[model samples]
Target: MTAEPALRLVDAAHPAASAEGVAPAREQERPETAGAQTLRRGLAVLRLLTRVGPGGLRMGEIGHRLGLNKTTAIRLTRTLVDEGFVLHDRAAGRYRLGPEAFAVGLAAEPSYELQRQAAGMLRALAAESGDTVFFTVLHGHESICLSRDEGDFPIRNQLIKPGDRWPLGVGAGSCAILAALPDDVVADVLARNAALRAEKFPRCTDASVLSLVRDTRERGYCLQPGMVFEDSWAIGVVVYDANEAPVASISIAALRSRLGPARSAMLGNRLMQASKELTAQLKA
Candidate 1:
């Protein structure tokens, strides 16, 4: 066949052919599959339970806080209870973490070595300072309160308990972790946590957090002067890993009246010393 006739025949046979063909459409338009969403919601319920302490939460409160519908919350909690990750207190009309949850947490002990190592330090700090001491670890753009020790102080700052999660720049220990990071990392963390900070921690703007980072770097510790709660003040010092990277922090929280400038500085230095000891232990 002549070149023109051959070309015409090829075009007729493959009229839709192109150098850049249309990309295939996605098979699943949703961000997550139904099964994945159910699993995520289930985990969310479990995390929420961790934060509420022994009191647990009512079904309506859980549904309200998580934005889960009444039926969905019921189903998820029922499944978790059936699986032994949760327990329904029929008499109290509430749900709390069950034995399986503790088992799972215990199984993950290796991941919480810092928490284990810092427990003694936390107790000593709390005893010496007559204040509440907390151990927090960095997790993504947030920080998790791994443990806490209470002092004999008459009035304690009970704002942050174990299992509480905060954006990196919100709490004293979290701010210490964020401040120990490089400037670029600090910026990225602020950007990622901006929305949550605005909604939950309105006072912790990027600018304000940067200011705190500068101050922490200068002082070798963080003094959270009633940022989270006007009457609650705290001091924090970062603990470094063997490679000298910041991994976790120790913090002391008390009433603002108790944390005067001199006392704040003293506590900050004390925390720094405790952090150094922990860092040495981790290095060993």
Candidate 2:
């Protein structure tokens, strides 16, 4: 006989062998450990720098916030400087975010352009709907108001200035964009925001907020009645880029009484149309 097959020989040696036995062995014994603590320290430094605005930060301050020794913080800062993510000022003895960081930022600059192009559309929509219109973008698990157009109505929702950040799932504009995010990104954002949600948005439950997100994806818009403010309703549509990823959202806030079923439906349609037009214009 030629010989018994390899599977047969192996099975003969181990009678109870299964298909799993025939599979290739894992390349590595176990997953490699990551330098997560170091990563966290680095991120903490970046956040502290951001909080200090563009003025840069002294080494002592960065060390104090991170609970790191000055030498340790200096080592980390040196790594960041080498990678082009941060820069150190020799005379001032301070560190600031550098050009490499800005390069990564440029990739996300489309959202800012989108906001600029949507300004006029938002204004027209606000004028037509008699409600405040807001253009918002998702930034590090929060939604930031990038621009706004106030309606003619004297009594309206409180104005939100550009750069003001809101929890991702708190308002319609944010929820709409979060709902349209890639599934994995949504999960990551939710995981990262669990504590924040508990602190700033005690009224919102994970299940209810996720349900709203699912419904937003299905309905092509998000409508929240009294979620952000009492006696007011916020409605929003996701603003997509050429690649179809959600880059921003446009929201309309109106009095709950005026946003009856019929009026709400009308406003939703207008908001969606305006969002589409702006997306097209921005891409152009």
CA lDDT of each prediction against the hidden true structure = 0.80, 0.72
Q: Which number leads on lDDT?
A: 1
Model 1 scores a TM of 0.82
- Give me the runs in candidate 1 sitting further than 4 Å from their true place: 1-34, 54-61, 64-67, 89-94
Q: Candidate 1 — what's its lDDT?
A: 0.80
lDDT of 1 by residue, 1-284 (tens): 11111111012234344122111111122588899999988988998888777889999999998899999999999999999999999999999999999999889989988788888878988899988888988888778778878787766555666676777898788899999898899988888777766755566778888888899999999988766666677899888987899988899988788899999998888888888888899889
The positional error of residue 204 in candidate 2, measured at the CA in angstroms, is: 1.9
Please give the RMSD of candidate 1 to the true structure.
Answer: 19.9
Q: Which pairs of residues have clashing backbones in candidate 2?
A: none
Give the per-residue lDDT of model 2 (tens digit) for 8-125.
Answer: 1112234344221111111112333457667866866765565455789888988986689988899888899899889999899899998987897789787477776777788888
| True-structure RMSD, every candidate | 19.9, 19.6
